[model samples]
Target: MRLLIFLIIVVPAAEISVLLLSGKTIGFIPTISFIILTGVIGAWLAKRQGLQAIKRVQEQISYGEPPGDALLDGLCVLAGGIFLLAPGFITDFTGFFLLIPAGRNIVKPLLLKIIRKMIDRNQITIYR
Candidate 1:
């Protein structure tokens, strides 16, 4: 709850400050153009990555294997796409990082650790 609140308040505040600074440093038109370009690129990357993830999931399913990793890839792609779509430089950077396979790999262990912690703490419950 506290983290959620902090993110909701701090993230926008930071984004706004960064946007203003970038606009001042690079001018409004360039900043807007960069944001638009990132959004377009992110959309394309997301679609491509998403399709690949789907293919992987389908293949895994066909082989009687769980698509857990593929689904996680899809989730990362989805999150990246969303962050890139938002009009903020920081988010665009983060989105780009998450969109790439290497970047997703970097984040995966951390994400798994958090999920494990949550499950251990009874903050998350899974049914099979």
Candidate 2:
């Protein structure tokens, strides 16, 4: 909870500062163009990854297996896309990592570990 609150406030503030500094150094037009390009690319990747997730889920269902973490993966992708859509280099960089397959693979395990710990601590509950 504390971490979430800190991230919510600090990340955006940091991003804004970085964006302002970069804009001042590189000029506004280039900075805007970079932000827009990232947004467009992120959107395309998000759509493609979303479709892939759906397909994987369908395949699992057909095989009598649950989709399980696929839903979590989809949510991460969505969050990453939203982060990328936000206008800032820090957010865009973080979003890119989340969107990338290799990055997703690395982050997923860490996230699952944290989630498991939270569940074990009774900080979070899983409902069927």
Candidate 3:
């Protein structure tokens, strides 16, 4: 799709621009150090959040309830962890936003809507 192509090209270009600007503004060593620090912290946060999501899923299963929401949370955390591990300031920020509960809440409905749309369009298939 055009949007995917735009993102694939634009996002990396933007990320590189920001990274170069950061290095020039803050000095290369400090910029790299900050990036490393954020990656470490983000990984830790993602792990903790992922564990909590797993617990929630288990609890829901024990109650004979569907684990959809918990599963979505796990997905967000997984994506966040991956983004954090990537070398870019924009991705690190997005990774943190996805990993944090408050921010995740802001995104969940949007994600759910997208999933529903995909399912409706037969773009995604779920097997029971």
Candidate 4:
């Protein structure tokens, strides 16, 4: 709830500030071009990573192993791609970060922790 509120308020403000500064520094056309370029690049990277993760999941399944890590990777890539689709510098940066392997590894544990907390609080339930 707090995170949702913070993002709703802060992300737009930060994006606007960054966009205004970029426009002033590099001119309007260049700023817009840069944003578009980042979006395209982020999308490409996310697709590549998502495919790789899916492949890993398939491999794990073939080996009769759980694909938990690969599944998380796919989720992260999906989120990164979604973020990239949004037209904002802050989101673009976040999208690129999430699309990267090292960044995904860094965030995976945090994401798992949050999920565990949600399960503990009955906000989420898992059935097997």
Per lDDT, the best of the predicted structures is 3
lDDT by residue for model 3 (1-128), tens: 99999768987898899999999999999999999999889988999999999999999999999999999999999989988988889999999999999989998999999999999999999998
Task: Estimate, for each residue in 1-128, the C-alpha lDDT of model 4 and write its tens digit.
Answer: 99999888988898999999999999999999999899878878988999999999999999999898999999999999999998988899889989999999999999999989999999998786
Candidate 4's C-alpha lDDT?
0.92
lDDT per residue for candidate 1 within 18-64, as digits (tens), equals: 99999999999999999999999999999999899999999999999
CA RMSD per model (angstroms): 1.3, 1.8, 1.3, 1.2
lDDT of 2 by residue, 56-128 (tens): 8888889988786786677678879888878789989888888888888888888888889999999999886
> Model 3, residue 50: displacement in angstroms?
0.8
Q: Model 2: which ten-residue window has the lowest total lDDT?
A: 67-76
Candidate order by lDDT, decreasing, is 3, 4, 1, 2
Q: How do the predictions measure up, each by TM-score?
A: 0.92, 0.87, 0.93, 0.93
| Higher-ranked by lDDT: 2 or 3 | 3
TM-score of 1: 0.92
Q: Which regions in candidate 3 have their CA more than 4 angstroms from the true location?
A: none
TM-score of 3: 0.93
Q: Ten-residue segment with the worst summed lDDT in candidate 3?
A: 6-15
Off by over 4 Å in 1: none
RMSD of 3: 1.3
Going through the candidates in the order shown, the clash numbers are: 0, 0, 0, 0
CA lDDT of 99 in candidate 4? 95
Q: Give the TM-score of candidate 4.
A: 0.93
Q: Sort the predicted structures by TM-score, highest score first.
A: 4, 3, 1, 2
